[model samples]
Target: MTPPILTVRDLVVTFGTREGVLTAVNGVSFDLYLGEVLGLVGESGSGKSVTGLAILGLIDPPGQIARGSITLDGAELIGKPEEELRALRGKRLAMIFQDPMTTLNPVLRIDTQMIEAIQAHERVSGKAARERARQALARVGIPSPEERLDAYPHQFSGGMRQRVAIAIALLHRPAVLVADEPTTALDVTIQAQILAEVQSLAAETGTAMLWITHDLSVIAGFADRIAVMYAGRIVETGSVVDVLETPIHPYTAGLIGSVPSRNKRGVPLAQIPGMTPSLAKLPPGCPFSPRCPRATVTCRTTMPAETPFAGARMARCHHPLTGEPLAA
Candidate 1:
């Protein structure tokens, strides 16, 4: 296993909302190695997206990184000034959202946007930047990149717009790319194509990618490792095969069981009971105890320490499915 290219430890993000200081992300931690895609999967409001945003220094206003360490290529990023963070954002760190419009400007031409993206970090001539933009579009499988560069966001279809967004994000070949469900809105056919293309691109460029999504099936064949998050905490982290095949945490097992493809035809889908807890009013013990079937009295009264297993696996639960003893 190569050294992790990006590392996050004990990340805590809080927002001072009307609900009274919500802890959106609580002590989250993970790592991403170059040329590997790590899937951050969980339901909505599970702090998956917030973790990604914090990595790129995008958490603003009432939200703050209350505690944590984010290191990229051996440099700490948690406390870097805004000026330095901005310079690093689209160059060393980049992100794409589920909606292409978030990355694309409807008022600007595609070529204009890409050219500016390149020139912002490099002293390149307009002609040179334009050429790089065209090549990037081509790399992402856009048709007739030369001509399409002159068009605006409105002119391209949904999928095409997303491809263009990906092109810009990868234009600088950033060391890390955070994709928050970039293919969620596209049809299955287009989604599959983009996933393959993005994975290929990441491998070719040696870019560590953190792909955030709520759909387990989306990352089934995409990510090298999977991190299961619930209520702002990671319950399990392991290789896709290991976690999906023999999940230790009940929340992880329930999540795998809820995947549509996991069930036989005509059978009702499995679902985790109870609603996600309010960040401001989380349980005193395990945040997931209210819904976790395997939760015991200890789980509802005392927080469980992360228990380690073979193959670099870890699950934060008291009664893990595995017969291993809890850490002392």
Candidate 2:
């Protein structure tokens, strides 16, 4: 097996609020192999985005990475100085955020932003950097790259803006890309195009991607492996086929069953009961016990250790759901 391009182990992120310190990520760990797309799927507030931010060392004031190490190509990123981390961003590791509107500077021309990004890490003439930026824009399927580069961020359509943001991230051909809901705001056609471009880029460049989103359909089609997170912890993880087709954790099954297309026509949607609890007031034992149908007294009384399953799959549950057993 190829050594992992990005490896995060036992990561924990906590935020300090007026109320108290709230844990956003708890003991999260995963490995992204070269050229592989690893999907982190869970509902909002499940810590999926927080995990990505923590990995990138983007957790700002009031939030902190309390534990764990993020290794990029065998280099430990945890506790690294901000100056060193800044150099790594975009050049070695890059991220495409959910909102392109906020990501780009309104006053800066697309060319200026992209050129600055390029020249920041590599010593290059303005002409060479501009050429690289234009090529990147073209690579991301933008038309008239030279003209587009001169346009301000506000002039571009939502989908186009996203493409521009993505193009900027790809300028350096970073070793790993942490894309947090990069297609959430685009139309279906645009979404498909972006996904295809991302897929192709990873294949050609061997850039490991951590594709974070709450959209299971996207994960089904794009992710090589899926990690199901809930209440700040990874509750289940396995190959995409195994996990999506035959989810073992109750929460995982609930998410799959709740998808609109999977339900019987005209029937009410099957939603997992109750809401995700607040991080500051998480329940004892299994964080998901409140909503898990298969949960038992044991589940509510003590946290379940991650149990190994067939095919390197694992689930943190006292009573793992064997889909068939529930049907019977």
Error of 2 at 69 (Å): 1.2
**In order, what lDDT does every prediction score?**
0.90, 0.90
Clashing residue pairs, backbone N/CA/C < 3 A, model 1 = none
Top-scoring candidate (lDDT) = 1
Candidate 1: misplaced stretches above 4 Å?
A: 323-328
Error of 2 at 76 (Å): 0.7
Local accuracy of candidate 2 as per-residue lDDT tens digits, 196-311: 98899778787889999999998799999999999899999999999998888989999998888834789898999999999988888999999988888988889977777887
Clashes of each: 0, 0
Candidate 1 lDDT (Cα, 0 to 1): 0.90
TM-score of each model, in listed order: 0.97, 0.96
Candidate 1 lDDT over 72-149, as tens digits, reads 987999999999998999999999999875668879999999999999999999999999999999999998999999
Report the alpha-carbon TM-score of model 2 versus the true structure.
0.96
